[model samples]
Target: MEKKSMKGYIYLMPALIVILLFTAYPLIRAFLMSFYEDYNMISGEYSRIGLGNYKDLFGDKDFTKALRNTSIYVVFVVPCSIALSLLIAVLLNSNIKCQGLFQTIFFLPYVTSVIAIGLVWSWIFNSNYGLLNIILSWFGIDKVQWLNKPKYALPSLIIFSVWKSMAFDILIFLAGLQTIPKDLYNASRVDSTPRWRVFWKITVPGIAPMISYAFIMGFISAFKVYNEVFSLWGGKAGPANSAITVVYYIYDKFYNSHNYGLASAAAVILFLIILVLTIVQRMMGRKK
Candidate 1:
């Protein structure tokens, strides 16, 4: 037994080594650097500034806006995506005709290129003569500016995100549904239990684990949303940075302004946010 365990450990060494080299080291380095002032990117020169970077970040209006936007996006996306995906999954799992076709149609968005989706959505959300507006015009409705204005820009992205993200979540919920024993439903049917009661009492509780997983995962992804905003609105965040997420803020700080220290601080804040949310989710799951 000892020798077998030793062999297993030896086999895992290569992957562990790679993780330490790439993931662990970078994270540790970044955390350490977050305490310092703008350390030279080209040269290895640096000066310690204590908490100045974080203090500045908290006070910065743009940073505050980015953080607020990220929080709002996460709040909207996580629960909405999970609920919609669960509904879709339930429908697809039911004894409906052409269910496989429906599943394929829903899952297509998940597999399709995100860049392509963003670009296509941009065209559809275009202020003038876009597909959605064209259709609205048929009913004599006015064409609302989808991506240009602040009020609609973030929501347009959120709508697309929820639709695209639902595919994978639907798959997960479907798998969870299958794991539920058929005997429970049979027993319910034998007792003439109402469908709604069985769903709420049996089906939902049985799938609680899946719901928790999806919620936590969606929350993290929404918090880190960047590429979608970038691709959707021609590289800029929005009309006036309405869609500037935390990750995008970090990127802008690092690339656009060459403020590496502030970027590191932002990254650290994001890491802490994700970590805390994950912990809270796990605690709630355990309580349930």
Candidate 2:
């Protein structure tokens, strides 16, 4: 038995080593850096400053704006993505022709490179010659500067994000829809149940777990959104900091400002937020 256990441990050692080296080491370093003041460039001298970095972060208006923008983006994008994905999944799962083609088309965005998606969307949202404004012009509407305008910039990012994220949620919902037994729908029909009522009572409950999972995943993804915003807004926070997100703020602090201490503090705060939100979502899911 001891020999067998030793062999098992040997087999697991590589993965354990990789996790320790990559995940654990960086996390420990970041946590330690959060308490430091200035980062040494030439001599590598990092002095301890207790909670001063965190205090600076809290006092920073840009950080606060980034947090607020991120929160709003999450609030809008998460539910919209999940609900639209679920609807699309239901449509695809029904008695429709070319179901496989539809699935491929919907899932394509999820597989596409973020940079490519951003570039394509940036062209589409261009104020004068873009496809969106062209269509709006057909209806006698004026051009709108999507990336340049503070009010429209965040919403534009959210729209693109929802489009990009919908594919994954659709696949998840499709899988859940398949797991729901056909008998439930047939039985409901035999009992003279209305179609809508059958869906509300049977289909909704059957896919509740998938819905919860999609919601949590979408929420987390929306919170961590950075690449799209960066690509669209020329790597700066969007106009007037409208499209600035938590992760983007952290990246700016760490790389642009060379403020590793405050960046790590921001990361710690983000981790706590994600942890609490995920726990609350799981608890609510269990109750349902």
Clash pairs (backbone) in predicted model 2:
none
lDDT of 1 by residue, 36-84 (tens): 8868888957787599889989999999999998888888888888888
- Scored by lDDT, model 2 comes in at 0.87
Badly placed stretches (over 4 Å) of model 2 are: 1-4, 41-44, 281-288
* Candidate 2 lDDT by residue in tens digits, 96-171: 9999999999999998898888988998999977898999999998998988899998889989999999999999
lDDT of each: 0.88, 0.87
Window of ten residues with lowest summed lDDT in model 1: 1-10
lDDT at residue 243 of model 1 (Cα atoms) = 87
